[model samples]
Target chain A: MKFDAQWIAFITILRKEVRRFTRIWVQTLLPPAITMALYFVIFGTLIGSRIGTMGGFSYMEFVVPGLIMMSVLTNSYSNVVSSFYGAKFQGSVDEVLVSPTPNYIILLGYVLGGVTRGLIVGTIVTLLSLFFTDLQVHNVAITVAIVVLTAMVFALAGFINAVYANSFDDISIVPTFILTPLTYLGGVFYSISLLPEFWQGVSQLNPVLYMVNVFRYGMLGVSDVDVGFAFAGVIVCIVALFSYSLYLLESGKRLRN
Target chain B: MAHALLINNLHKVYGNGFEALKGISLQVEAGDFFALLGPNGAGKSTAIGVICSLVKKTSGQVKIFGIDIDKDFSAAKCELGIVPQEFNFNQFEKVRDILLVQAGYYGLPRSLAEERADKYLKQLGLWDKRDTPARMLSGGMKRRLMIARALVHEPRLLILDEPTAGVDIELRRSMWSFLRDINAAGTTIILTTHYLEEAESLCRNIAIIDSGKIVKNTSVDSLLKTLNLETFVLDLREPLEVSPTIENFSLRLIDSQHLEVDVTKGQLLSDVFSRLLQEGVEVLSMRNKTNRLEELFVSLTGSGAGENDEI
Candidate 1:
């Protein structure tokens, strides 16, 4: 297909993916915002009042960036996993599969769709945080770049999960067993500096820890991990995940016969 | 004239070691309406899947409009459209959006996509249901929606797997007319149908497949001409005590009121009527036991048409 046509095909898939989640805003958009708002109330205000500042900032302020990143990560991952798995389940993905659309274009379209939802939900949670705490961004470029990059990484991961998923239960297994635990343990509510030296070393091995730290550094100008290394690590994850997802699509794994 | 679709030595084997297609080769000429008749598990759907890229071929060559699929499938697929047996569209999407989205996948501009969507929706009689979600449509309407969606891309070749399965006779006839119009206008169509009568009526050329191979491939008229014997069931006006003794014809009394008679080539129907009349038997009505192509299909496939025949 010509480049122009491929672009149209990409846009079409993206449009369909966007409309899918938007059509069910109550399920896709609302729950995350509500969940994040409750976290701010229960964890930041109610619990943080007893604990002093960590990482050179108040508990509420320090936790805001982590909460936002958490929403972005989960929403991005869930959006692609659910949307792509739904397409596979309904066999609607055959629409693009039988078309002349390139594999890369299809992957990009879905990845961007996850990114869009992730950013939208992330912004919603960020705004919701303002009601509980005054949020500040130390570096706008680092903040925007890391968030977008992090969303892309998780979106790619979700795409891979959806590709290998055979049933509705399969799509949920990763998020529930893997993603949720990683977010909680990834230092979302507290900095890893407070952990014992051995546990801090173990936490460094968790990829989500790097993402949350980079995002926290962006928002509060403080991070336990090196920001440069964290950015490079997220980029590496994106490249690896994107390549694998593209290979799955090109090979027609699970999507085709 | 160029061939619209060509498969040379095509083969497909499933992961479970079931060889669905065993080197089946066929050609469909441009502008012809073709029927691929087969029994269940005869590999008709698998072949179509390979051509549409829904199924991977173990070994073979498939080309659409002279473009080789393996070499450049994207280019080959651009000229092809398929309506699978199952309803595969998003059920929650409005009818019009489905068509428009399909058009966009083929790189149709918004104006052109809308125009084509409008044209096909109106043509398929789904214009009024444009805003309604696909799940709300009846079985026949959903089939029409799929056909419209396939045509929105204006593909040169269209493959429909049992396009009229489960459709009412009245609606089936209308769909046949619509398909005839499109084939006349130069879209090559390959249809698989359980209704042999549908194939006999709409398709000019046909291939009957059995056990993953093309048992017979010829024009519809030629295949029908090869059926030298046809059975007719006669409803008698009164109950008969025994079968009538007709010379050079086989007759069996299905019950007492109905008799099945086989008439071979060069046999006169008038002779049967005369013989029955001479035997003091009155016939109320007479109809063929099965359509011409159906009889030949059973004879070739060696499988009773009972389980496979939906018509």
Candidate 2:
């Protein structure tokens, strides 16, 4: 329909989403920040001191980008999956389904909300990390671009998860089983170079590893994986997830009926 | 009158192979307050769901204001508003904001949506709670808020599914008056309620759907005329034994002091009165049980009529 009208709907849904998380800041925003702080304390301070260098940079500096990306990924994915699923469970989603707003606009509005939360949490964790270690960015543009792209990719994944989720348990299943394993093996604490060549090749297949290393490269100018390959991986994931999410919305597969 | 809604042989079967609707068809005229009456599991909601595209229809077609919902859903939905049976608004949002967001979904400009939101909220007695979150409002207020949200875009046809389900008597009356006022202003209202009296009072044309089939569809006046039985309740001043004069009329003694009788259209009431006098039975007061429409609804739908069974 009209541009202004679609913009209004976008802003309304975004505002509602932002308010929902902020209203329960303890659960939505604070826990992730605190969890990241614990990782910095336990992993960076306690463990990193025992094992000094990780891929040429100091242990604290090497893990900062990975930890920040980790927070961004988890928060963005959880924000959208939980919010959209909650709307579905409460039947409030019918408000959008019955309206004249285009399906793509609805999907984008929710994806943006998720991305916003991810960026917000990522910023907070980055600031928290600064207190423990002196932070420096070799390329601010690449760092910003990689973090935003990573958030977008994960947000789209969350929307797909929400669409397929029939119960609250369904929402948590992926985060615990799939996401946790991927992030753990994504070189958050150690470089993939330390593993054997075969394991390194296997780790190359983990998408989160590419994200973490690329973000590390942006901050430290060093990565266990090629920066170009990392950026390419992020772009491919974004395109694929974006197209798939759009297709799901257009088909009205599980969301509509 | 132009038809506002036309359904032709709509069908719906669930993925599990359970059929909810079976070839249902009906037409609602422009500006006509049409009531679809049926029991639970009778597919009234399923029919609404299919027309709104919230549920997949197995076959048939639905046209809203001459636009096919299947081919031109956006255009069709733009002209229709549905107030669902459940409270589906965001409870975290303010009453006014809920309506504004719904209007935005319909692609209405901010200024226009806000103005319409204010108008409807005030008319529905929800303006005082405009800034309150929907969770804070009572059930009746929330229901009214939904009505306000549905009317924000000012569609040509409005479908209300049991809008007064759990509301009190006073609120129900006020809601009915508000709906009637809106209908008078040219909005076609399609209501589905278990309360048959509400339908009988508000709708001129009615459709009785039973077991997912249209059992009766006709003007209210015509349906009432078909019921030839008129019930008369007489209060007797003195208790009287059985008399042969009373045998001429079909009568049942409800109690020692009250007698109920059914009088056909061709029978004269004066004859009953004269016969009662001849039998030495004093008649204190007499009144018709109710309007003929009540009897017609009971007989046609086969729902027994009792004073407490108004719904």
Candidate 3:
């Protein structure tokens, strides 16, 4: 491959994807901000005041990292799924496929587009969290790393979902049946330690639990799961999902022919 | 240096056991205006799909300018452009944005892309619609937009599949002039059209495919030469109460002031005029009853062009 052409193609797709979502900012960017605000108002402010504290931090502050992670996760996943599926549905994907853009560049460009939305929403949700409670970053590196990795993993997951989806309904099924349930049980509103021993083990089986805890640990210096194990798990999942996504792209699964 | 396009033994079988193309090999020399015509389901689109990498070939070698598609696809693809029969652009995107994004796909810088976008849009009479959303454009303008988008990279070879399928005649004529200018400026063009007249008027060489095979491949003049008989429609100076008869001539009275006649090989059209004049029917104007190539295409493909065939 000519490296310059590859980079150019990647940037082109990335920029186009960004322009698409940004152009419809009302549809793409606003809803999440409103939803996150409602979550902060309802769960963190009203319910949190009565609960008082958990995990050695104020209840509002305790839920802040997870909420931010939730925004990042969902936004990352939805952005790629909708955008990619739209491309396929409208046959606009043919534009890139018939061009000199390499498959990997196409993949990276879309993934980065998802990542961009994820981080933007994450930042907005984080800023919203500040209004409800004073927050501190116990570890900046872990905070950035875990959030980035989690966004990437879900973005890859969304890419795979879009590839396999034959209809618009197929794209939303996984998020509805799997992602929502996993995130809610992943300790966003409460620590898994509050659950019974068996259910806590069950909660640990959820991948989102690992991400939310890692993010929480980065913010509050407190976690129910081992920080080292969470780091390892997130890295492994990222590597595995990234490899699989690349494989699907290289094989042109659901993309070509 | 090699031919502008070379496909050797290309084959494609759909998942449902229908073979769309079967071991078709063809070449278009550099700077040639070539036409690929076929009835519906005759494998023209399939062959194009294989070359554009939109469809996976079961087996074949495809080279663009001597660069094998498999070995150097980016380089090969960068050297070509495709205007598909369908509109495949992002509907929500502005027309100029569509062209710019297509340019970016080919690694052209923004400044050059904008320059080319303006140039092609102006040439195609689409500069005024640059800011409008694509879906708002008329069907003819949308086709023009696809052409502008394809040419942003300044590709050496351009392939058009039924480019004027739904375009109005006035727009089609202007588009033909635009295409002629580009072809004259040295961009090799490969066209597939249902309009046999379009092919007959523009293409230098032609290939007709049927049932996944190339039925005829030759120069346009040579292909037309195979046409042994051509029918002509004549407008008369006087109204005829009845159809006229000329020796060894197949003539029919279309109306009071019109007549249709067949002129076979080795027969002079002047003789038909003289014979008609002797019959007291003065000829005002004469024209082919139908496109000459359309007739030949129907003969070769075993089916008519621009009809109900949907392969």
Going through the candidates in order, their DockQ values are 0.84, 0.63, 0.79
Give the CAPRI class of candidate 3: medium
Model 1 misplaced regions, further than 4 Å: B236-243, B255-257, B274-284, B303-311
lDDT of 2 by residue, A115-171 (tens): 999999999999999889998898898899999999999999999999899999999
**Candidate 2: tens digits of C-alpha lDDT, residues B94-194:** 89989988888888878998899999998999989999989999999998999998899999999999999999999999999999999999999999997
Per-residue lDDT tens digits for candidate 3, residues B1-311, read 69999988888998888999877889999999999998999999999988888888898899999999989888899989999999999999999999999998888878888999999999888999999999999999999999998899999999999999989999999999999999999999999999999999999999888888787888999989988999999999989989989998999998898899999998999999998888888999999988999999888877443323322
lDDT for each residue of candidate 3 in A1-257, tens digit (9 for 90 to 100): 47876787788888988998899889888898999899889888898889988987888898888889999999999999999999899888899999988787888999999999999989988887788888899999999999998999999999999999999999999999999999999998898889999999899899999899999999988888898998899889888888898898777778887
Clashing pairs in 2: none
Q: Which is the better candidate, 1 or 2, if ranked by DockQ? A: 1
Model 2 chain A poorest ten-residue lDDT run: A248-257
Off by over 4 Å in 3: B303-311
Candidate 2 local distance difference test against the native:
0.87
- Better structure of 1 and 2 per lDDT: 1
Scoring only the second chain, what is candidate 3's TM-score?
0.94
**Clash number for model 1?**
0
Q: What range of 10 consecutive residues in model 3 chain A has the weakest lDDT sum?
A: A1-10
Whole-model alpha-carbon lDDT for candidate 3: 0.90
Best by lDDT: 1
Q: Across residues B1-311, which tens digit of lDDT does each residue of candidate 1 receive?
A: 55899989988999999999888889999998999999999999999999999899999999899999999999999899999999999999999999989988889888999999999999999999999999999999999999999999999999999999999999999999999999999999999999999999999999988878888889999988887889999999999889988879999999999999999998999999988999999999999998888888888788643323221
lDDT of 1 by residue, A1-257 (tens): 99889889889989988998999999999999999999999889999878888888899998999999999999999999998888888988998899888899989999999999999999999989989988888899999999999999999999999999989999999999999988999999889988999999998999999999999989889998999999999999999999999899988888888
Each candidate's TM vs. the true structure? 0.96, 0.93, 0.97
Q: B12 in model 1: Cα distance from truth in Å?
A: 1.2
